[model samples]
Target: MTLTESVNLDNCDREPIHVPGHIQSHGALLAFDAALRLAACSDNAERMLGFALPALGADLDAPQFAAWPHVTQAIGDFAQRSHGTSGLAERSEVQVGGRVFDLILHFNGRLVVAEFEERQPADREIRPFTTLANGALGRLRLQRTIDDLLQVAVTEIRSLTGFDRVMAYRFRHDASGDIVAEDCRPDVEPFLHRRYPAGDIPAQARRLYVINTLRFIADVGAAPVPVHTAGAEPLDMSWATLRSVSPIHIEYLTNMGVAASMSVSIVIGGELWGMIACHHLTPMVVPYGKRMACDVLAQLLASNVQTLLAADHAKRIEAASSVRVQLMETFVGGDGLLAALRPHAAALCTTFAADALVASEGTETFVHGGVSAAAGAELLRWLRSSKPPEGLLAMSEQAKLPPVLSAALAPWCGILALQMDDNRHDWLVLLRPEQVETVAWGGRPEKVYKAGPHGMRLTPRGSFDVWRETVRGIAVPWSATELEIARGLQAELHRAGGARRAQVARDRDQMLAVLGHDLRNPLQTIAMASQLLARGADSATVGPRITRSSTHMARLVSDLLDLSRLQGGLGLAVEPKPADLARLVREAAQDVTLGHPGVEVAVEAPPQLQVPVDAARVRQLLDNLLGNARQHGEAGRPIVMRLEASATQVTLSVANHAPPIPPESRDRLFDAYKPASLNNSRNPGGMGLGLYIACEIARGHGGTLVYEYHEPFVVFVVTLPREARAAAAGEA
Candidate 1:
């Protein structure tokens, strides 16, 4: 037979579990029509309820049911009170045939379903709920791993319910299940480590498992009775405790030699993660209270499972982060990209267990281990053509490869790649070699044909004989943790590339702005001076104008270059010698007075204040400061230049009467290209680089430049060491 024919794939998911047409022998079920007439009863009704099956049209209050008068009134009261709802009534206890039973009633469509189960004796000793629950919780808490936890859960549940076998079956990403942990009777064959296909529990059945956390079948071999209704419709017994089960499921259980079964769902993050399945070789019924306890246990276990999984995930992320830090450091500290990643290539490839790694930038390819150069080129071409997502792109099998590239990449079955840049064709690829794996399936995982009352139909596999198959053309599966780490690496690389591009763009724009605005006036002045000389104007007048314009242009260019060098991590080059500070201050003040003839300048300093310094750079520093004071300071105010000498340091203070600096601009005053104020109309000609250059000069001389606002005046202070040893050492 063909695979599909053998497993009966057509009927796998068609089983109507809600209307199974059967009920457990431990309970008696009866359905009444809209007229309140007894329409149907279970075949075992006479044995359990001490009453023969009622005729199809007999009244529900017949003489056989008169022994319990409460049943008739209870049904009437339920029908009246449960309006506009599911019509399920609260269970009531009644004595019939000298035996107490718990009666549950609910309306399904036009029929009312009543089910009865034998109640526990009044004198039977019951175990304390708190004791059992606390013990189980304590044992569960002591488990440090998921395996230990599952083992404890199945053992405790089986012990509590007295089932012959209990297994913790965990679902995979594809909805297939594996028996992770089990506790069964020693005489029975173990189902541990067994796997089941996803089709075994159809989609609809999985939905019901989520809705109803727990389900039980007292006996799989019990006879079913038709749930009759005057309208010829079947009742939906999805929520009924004693509802009949599907014949296919019954056959499935019987094939395994199981007479009863129970299942409790284990949900995590609002999704069904797995289930706790229980089975027995003989018919059995679990009490409501015990089932309630199992439900609580399942909930607690689900919570613990979430916590443990999160902890494991966090641990993996931490390890990956460490590796990422090392890789980034190497990339940043080395000369070229290929050379940087080369030293750490093995470490990077091992993160996801790939046999080879390739780093590609444009047409250049750097291989780490076993990947061929042709394969790398082909992979890159495919990646560029496909334009995959920004994060990690993973392919588990070579079949996913393009036809043109599949034969070239035959040695590698899997590829995990990440694009490092959004605008560039730079990629990091990890390749895994083809791995052949042998998987032991419970059966062929195909449907089989069978003869039934309705003629030939599809059925589930009846024989669970071990069927081993060797799977080829695939590599080892990539784990969630590995994929997460790959995504993180991709994000980090993208951010780094974006930052570098942004810096380059900023630099280009700043250069353009300076060339277009700040340098235009100086160049124009030179042109005007040359035109005057060419026109035979007075030689002396054109000479000074030409000299002044050229000097100004040179100073602007020098300041720009100095700022660039400082930013590039090359500090100012200076030479220092013993000099008279008071003389230097006097000369700087005289130069400022020449430049700004209208402004009054005052100098206060002791004579012969000697210090070791670079006189020219210090002069440049003073010129920039005094020039800034003239441009932004009040026009009529006197500028004060003061020099103070101490044992080990000299302080130069320049003060002017000007409006206080705005709070927003104070922090970025010494930053290159940052305007002195947002309202640039006040000081329009300045390039905002003077103060930045001044600060760099002061730092080069082992001094600091700072600004302070004093209500009516702003002060710029320069403090330098008297000996200037740092400047001398830097010069060397």
Candidate 2:
């Protein structure tokens, strides 16, 4: 009956207004009248905006409503009925505040009725030149080393524009596509390692993923591409959703839902290589500029992928023919082919963060990188299971690997499986992605799988791994230039493997020799010290001597243990603070003097020369140098000790009257088990581990321990590189 009720009826489509009894009964009509007028349309509606839009009756007297400059002048006339222009209907789309609206004007009786309909911002920028340049240049850059090149391109773009998840969605022969490279959400599990089957994306939808170089579905629930076209001809199967797709797409998504999706195709050489997919958990309406920026990013990625892949193809030829020929001489029937190709692995394959050239012999495998035998076994199992009879098969599903293997190889995210033989000569060159987020696309819909009673079930658009292309055939024909490079690499790896084996043997021999000789001297020292004490000397004299001898003996044992710990990769536990060098020097001198009563040990250090050093290690260092000087150098010459402190380095030099070491020997004087006789000591007691251990200790604290072969006096200097005095002062 009232204006409010009339308006409500129109919206409700003949249904009665459902106002609550409690909110009605009194002054309802008055309150509802104001509410109905206010709610007739949006605040900007022409009917509600009288100040901005002149009343229909006042149009003749009112200043003519200034036609928007974007609209055509004259507007074709709204009041020439006799001239057949009165019934003219005019409608155009207008943009205001990044939103588009359909502006319609109609002549009714003697007045004009104007209405506006909201239109989505689905219109694209018409920059044919920009698009052409991007498409052309982008495709060229992408084909080089497609794997690493795409990853880098995606990473750089993602950084430039912050996107939650970005990926490289690669197309397959089947209509479906998979996200091969991805930078995923921080808390979510990585989706880099799995392949999505064709069923994952419907045939028609996938066609769009490839054809539509840049497609944005802002809000799936709101703006949908209508499939109905009255005059359209029969759709070809190749077209994406040309006819009509089921509502199941929305239901299927709602079941395993993605709220928003933005896909940018990676087209190389006019063929769709892949797409950059950006996803969102909640509904998002992307800004026009943002979408354009992503399109530009995709163009860059496409170019890089093409460039890099072409380079890879060339490299593969070089490896298979030329490199293979060279490898034949060294490896024969062995898996040494992969070992020969390692030096170029970094440059040739940039997607890999770390790599290993592993040789498979039967079930057993040998690794050339820093992998242990146990680790090698795990790696071999993975490669053998997936590798082809010949050539390479790249795998990106490292995260889904077994716990043991994945735990050990947590650093690498991908693997390149290459088979060299039917027997005991298969090789796996593993590749680790630099960061988990490098290859991600910006518009891949998030897939969430529901957890079942047994375990998690993978659902459509749910979290899973992805791999682009895993080629299983041999290198497709080789060129002259390619053969030469491959052969060179193969030869190089063969030589390298031999050199590696030789070095390992030499290291093993050195360790064994050091162990045998170093272990014996301490036992001998302890036995001699015990024998001397057992002889008939006064308990007062013998007891002190025995203690002093035992102290040095204990020091030998401790040094050996510490050296073992360092060599075994255990870090030193340091509790550093300010320490006085003079006090430590005096204490070390006193300890050295306890055993040798006849020798006069003197310390010439400044009283207040303070330095930051590990007190225990410094004391042991001074003790060993002084002891070596007394036992090997001229016993009569005073073991002069001087401590010098500069702004950055604290130097403790111990000089003794010993023959100058040979130039060659000086370089290796601090090496473990190197004969101490090089310092002109006839009786170089204790293992050569003393200086070696000392040097290790010094370096651990950002310092150096070097032996200077000064004429007549070989000086062992411990230089501790420290923060500047000004820095120390600042901290203080």
Using lDDT as the measure, which candidate wins? 1
- Report the lDDT tens digits of candidate 1 across residue range 36-120: 7877666667778886655767886787667667877777677666662554456677677788777778776566778888867
Q: Rate the local accuracy (lDDT) of all candidates.
A: 0.75, 0.50
Q: Quick one: how many clashes does candidate 2 have? A: 54
lDDT of 1 at 261: 92
Model 2 lDDT tens row, 291-402: 5556676777666666666787676654455434544443432223332343444443332333444455333344545545556566767666654433455445554567
Q: How many residue pairs clash in each candidate?
A: 8, 54
RMSD of each: 13.6, 24.1
What C-alpha lDDT does candidate 1 achieve relative to the native structure? 0.75
In model 2, where do residues sit more than 4 Å from their true spots?
1-555, 568-578, 586-604, 627-640, 647-649, 655-683, 699-702, 706-716, 721-732
> TM-score of predicted model 1?
0.59
